[model samples]
Target: MSAVVRGLVARGAGQELTVEDVRLPRPDAGEVRVRIRAAGVCHSDLSMVNGTLAPPFPLVLGHEAAGVVVEVGDGVERVRVEDHVVLNWAPACRQCWFCRHDEPWLCASSGTPAVARGATADGAQLHVTLGLGALAQEVVVPQHAVIAVPPALPWAEAALLGCAVLTGVGAVNNTAAVKAGDSVAVIGLGGVGLAALTAARAAGAGPVIAVDVSPAKRELALAAGATDYLVSDDRLAKTIRELTEGRGVDHAFECVGRSATIRTAWRSARRGGQVIVVGMGAKDDEVGLSALDIFHSARTLRSSVYGSSDPDREVPELARAVLDGSLSLAPLITDRIPLDAAPAAFERMARGEGARSVVLFDE
Candidate 1:
């Protein structure tokens, strides 16, 4: 048995996505077939399309999604049919070197072809993005890739938990270990930036500053609990320092995934402060710093992959925060459209139009 479903497929680098009929096979052993209810359009997906992060072509390009498990293959014990789950793109293999060493987010086998199991209508093997493609109405992923969430959780908001929320909040809570009264600045006001803002506020960080080039995102940032907002410009670092009493923020987050924004994040941090890189940038893009400056800065630079999250443990906690009103997933979702409208959504994202645009599927 097979399912023919419409999905956004990227046929080649720098090409626009085409909605095509994808033929998905039934769940193989250790796999689960999910009926995607909602999927978030992320910059990472755009990177795959634009050739920044090269995945195999003819790929289904989406990873942030939530859905219901409609069927499970033999030996699947993590979840049962009808279980609501947040699709985790990086499903760690516990026996892998990274996982055994407590760095499961960097699991060696998470996003390889060895884990993908699907095909296209023409019988060509389909390469799923991050090994958990959610652009389609249905997906068959490894059992570990689906983390069960409460059924009461709304599919649209829960969809973001897999990517933006985990990366944003996890960066603060797990990676940076932000403490109360620490000054924080987030350079970018997208879903990930807002999630950082919300987590910073929850952590009692002082003067959580949000920076972005777009003036329209000020309100969204403020509503997400940023104490201050600044537009990205030549004097951004000076303005941030002035706001922090001639000292830059204690912690700065780079969420835009560009060399320029990354420089801004590094320059906006106080001496000895931590600059956390949360965005996924192009492999070729590089940020240059003088040797003397690096020596004198006395700052720590680190990258936060998937928010340094262990999905099995963090996704549920994040969901609980949303359920308890401690976290605001509502502000992050700026637009909701059907799957066919994903191209327009991508255009909006490219224009920095809104925070997140989710593709909703019929119940």
Candidate 2:
């Protein structure tokens, strides 16, 4: 049996999120009901509040969550009852061209068939944030969106691998694939930026420069593996070149979603280097780059969605890294609040004052 639990929901723009009791129905075929243990409060939630990620009304606003599987619907063999798991927002359908071609992250972009999963408590059907909305105490998601984890990994630490960690680390390791001894510059020291720093360090990158406006975040970046830190400003481009002996770093990752930061990430890369745009800036915003630069610089820029990840393969490996102390996730948490405090937590994120606030639930 599953219990109705509290969760944060954005009714609309400029409106306070109301904490409500929502029900979780029994899992249908190819579905599982998860009892969410920890949900990360991400900036995307603030975007939803301010009408940035405008999808639907009264949306459950979080994508980074991990929990336990208490019940599995029919034909669910990958996970069993009581199995610990990480909820992935992007699930790939095996038959899709992207999935069959070794790029599951680009899975056809179709809606999950609702016949496989039951409706919400209020009988008002809703779409999951990227497909797995794990913010609630219970989530009825397709089996493909769930990644089972080792019991030793705490739910809170594992939650981030679902999105933030994957986007950050995967941007460097998978998308950029920066080589050992390469120089890196990462703009925006949020959760993903910090993860990028750690991944860059692990990849043997030298002089990994971290750029951000927040000094607290600069400190966080240093702890995560940044060799140097800088404040974001009009001189950011010039400073990045100055740091890399007037050549700039080999790779630059923009994890913060903004046009200016996006351009900064581009300029931070050395000529012929790679610039990976991991940030999700406004669709309307455009960057002004001299057409000659494309030919003159020979740099490569690519969009990183879900960190180009295959969750079934990446989540468990990340969890193992966490267990070995090579991946420091437990310390990244700045606030741990109950499900009721989600609104306040998101507000804190909007103010750029929190590291990673997680919403916990009694399981």
Candidate 3:
């Protein structure tokens, strides 16, 4: 038997999303059914529609989400019915070479942009974002797609832990290996960027500068523990260098997934510093770099996929921090909205108007 639930669906690229009935199949062996409680509107979700990514039509949109396991398959053991969990969009295949080598984030079998599953109300085949169309009220995913978290964790905050918190913090701790007193500049003040700021501050990084195209993000940047905020402009690199006393920052994080922003991040770092690309960009959107500049700067450029994090080991630890109040996700969530408001949330994200607009579901 299948379960019917409401989900946000986009029939084609650039089309307005519609709330429609989605019929989900029952969890088979090694699978589980999750009732989504909260889902964060992430930029990656926006990419699915804004031409940055090309996913199948009639796609269910969402990935950053938290929910409860309401049904478990015969072989399920990691979670039980009613267990709170965070959706792991990039679930690792433990037997893959990456997983065997401790690089599960680069799991060979995961991270598909869209997976064919379920059906629309009219019985047309459906595709889901990142294999977990969490914008829906319920989803049937492989057991590995859900990570158990503290039950006491709020649904909204927990949803963010799946993507924003994990990616941002993981980029800092795991990918960049940022140490105390390291000067940092983060470009883009979206949910992930702000989360990066919070993690940087927690790691004792100083002069943590936040940059974004929107001037309105100043307040958000400061609240997220940034020592300074700058509106992204032609002078961004020079300004960052000035703030760093002509040395530029030790690390520059490009949270906006654009070639121009990537170059800006590259320029915002000091010679021999690291420029970490935290945002996902379109493949054709190439960043032009001069060979002479690369040699002269001697800076390293790398991209952090899923924060280069293994969600299974990190989500539980992050949940504990949220439970103990050692890690605060308050700044990450700018609004708590109902599911119906999800389309508007995407608009806000497109405009770079807020940090994160979390869609909350009623229990």
Output the worst ten-in-a-row residue range by lDDT, candidate 2. Answer: 110-119
The residue pairs that clash in candidate 3, if any, are none
Off by over 4 Å in 2: 1-3, 110-127
lDDT per model vs. reference: 0.90, 0.80, 0.94
Q: How displaced is residue 287 in candidate 3, in Å?
A: 0.6
What is the full ranking by TM-score, best candidate first?
A: 3, 1, 2
Against the true structure, what is each candidate's TM-score? 0.97, 0.94, 0.99
lDDT of 2 by residue, 210-283 (tens): 98887777678788898998988899989989988999889989888887887788888899989888877766
Best by lDDT: 3
Q: How far is 105's C-alpha from truth in model 1 (Å)?
A: 0.9
Candidate 1 segments whose C-alpha is farther than 4 A from its true place: 113-116
Query: Which residue pairs show backbone clashes in model 1?
Result: none
List CA RMSD, all candidates: 1.3, 2.3, 0.7
Number of clashing pairs per prediction, in order: 0, 0, 0
Ranking by lDDT: 3, 1, 2
